[model samples]
Target chain A: MNKSILTKREKEVFELIIENYTTTEIALKLKISEKTVRNHISNVMQKLGVKGRASAVVELLKLGELSI
Target chain B: MIKRRFIKKVLVTSAVLFAFLLMCLIPNNNVLEPTQQLEYVSSEVNKIPIYLLDSHNMLGRTNVAINSKEIDKQARELLEILIKEKGDNKLPSGFKAIIPSETVINSLTYKDGLIKVDFSSSLLDVSTENETKVIEAIVYTLTGIEGVNKIIIYVDGNILTKLPKSKINLPSTLDRSYGINRDYSITSYHDITSFNVYYLSKYNDVEYYVPVTKYVNDSRDKVEIIVEELKQGSYDNNLMSYLNYQTELEKVDYDKNEIALTFNEYIFSDADNREVLDEVISAISLSIADSYNVEEVVFNYKNEEIHKSVIKMLE
Candidate 1:
């Protein structure tokens, strides 16, 4: 909805994050490093023109990229 | 001007949306629909490995006892597997007879020469035949685990007054499952150390056999020690040496509330660290807990604390 693309992995991480996973939880679930999850989250925020976590989540929800 | 308007809108919109979202996600003052609350075997992956499932999957091996301080556990698992795969009769709705879906294995300890297995349950009412089958399943099964020789079963966190007649004889014969016994029966009893068990090499694996003679010539205490040492060395030699266990079971007395445990040695060396002491204490606590009916297992040091490591099993 923000005209930005979400890679498959990023999309997966976002879905989990919205499901209330902490950063470490997401890393464990994906079997990736916590730093890698952070990197993707940063990219997600930048692509959506958001500065931080709350806005990124809100923007994703607004664009219907997420479901409750 | 545009930025100020957008910032105001963002704050107001986020506050309302977040409140609404939070309300939806959290269950608070929500009206409930009439619902059925039936329970199923919890599919939680990290739950206690039902002894039956573990044994059914043939975890560890029949040739050796499971020694991770969980023989009762392994036996319970063996029973559960036998029940699920083998099935049972007169089992109640929530009552499982053979494969105990969940059982808490507190600890197995080897102090002096005696081995103690502690479990959390009251197994007295389990049918006599079921009990005997379960014990034999454990004893025979534990023969495959490490750090166990003879076992005293405990249920509901205490020892029983009488062993159920689900009696299975303890055999020293070489069974290929624990290892191999290609020449097990052929080993000569001569030159066998007093009270020591003998094993013969066969088919690339070790086969165990009780010495042809009973340990009658030695003190019962000494035989108990020899068997425990063999058990400690059963699976991982490193584990046997890790505790550096030097104490002997001096006397073990019990009441419903507490068990009095004594040892021959002071049990720690000048070289040992707190961690070593902790492991030793836990091992003893779990073992003693398994052998008696009690809440606390008091050690010989005159009011020493119950070991914490073994207590963690309760959690």
Candidate 2:
């Protein structure tokens, strides 16, 4: 998958999720609405065609879009 | 005769099909028109883009234009929004107030090209990492107004010669020369040349232009530096740049007070929306306009006119 295809905000949300931040924690840390945080997660998951947030993170890691 | 007529019909049909195919192949420039009103609505109060620092420490500008008619009121309102502690009105994701939470602008005055901004003592309580960004947020936001060039910051009627927590000394008057995106990686500070470049960042699904002032030891012209920097994309990992990574500057020419940049086709490839394209143009124009005393910026692709924007500086 093309890495540059994901937006800056999506990358930020994905990184936070990978770091084990909950949706509420991500919302608080990024200073955005909880709905917006959920939107980002769903958007990323949709883009990667993953069913769950965990699968999305796994796909991103497998694609080398995220690293430990 | 019948066969000739039938051949003519077939030729005409194929010609029409070829023409339709060609039309589909041509790139549509009209698709990039502004479809959404660029407004930041928070708490029933319409907030325009005031420059603010992101979590990764990059300056993101708002897409909304400055309300020139009521400069003072808008400035004060934006300042209030900037300093307000956690409120129902939320900032875009990954961005936060540069000014500390408890800080308040007690008074703001514009006189003789200088904006005397008096802030409450709470402004001094910023941490060390935020010391410069806080000062930048104030100066940049204030000087963005018409007729304001320099800023004199004060804490309760006293000039802030040094930051309260970090103790970083301040120049008596601060302006754009104070620079954004100050690179601490440089070893030889004197040889550094500063250039202001704009990158795109999205908040609440609306793309905003983020201006980053880069200091490099290279001595290239400011316009070339900007185009190159823009092509290199945002230094901040979390910030998105609208310019495609493959975009290449074909040529740069300065004539009759106008700076023109010719770039490759990749510049338009990533812009899926007209508003985004317009922001890309403004971001490039504003960055160049802020750094150079130029009247206009002309963007060209393949030696053909793509777009031209008049440089309207805040002051």
Top lDDT: which candidate number? 2
B179: Cα error in model 2, Å: 1.8
TM-score of each: 0.28, 0.60
- Candidate 2 is graded, for docking, as incorrect
Q: Report the poorest 10 consecutive residues by lDDT, candidate 1 chain B.
A: B174-183
Top candidate, metric DockQ? 2
Best by TM-score: 2
The lDDT for every candidate, in the order shown, is: 0.44, 0.69
DockQ of each: 0.00, 0.01
Candidate 2 local distance difference test against the native = 0.69
Per-residue accuracy of model 2 over B230-282 as CA lDDT, tens digit each? 76776567555566667777898889889888887777854453222665687
Residue-level lDDT tens digits of model 2 in A6-68: 678888887886565778988998999989998987888898897886566555543435533
Residue A33 accuracy (lDDT) in model 1: 100
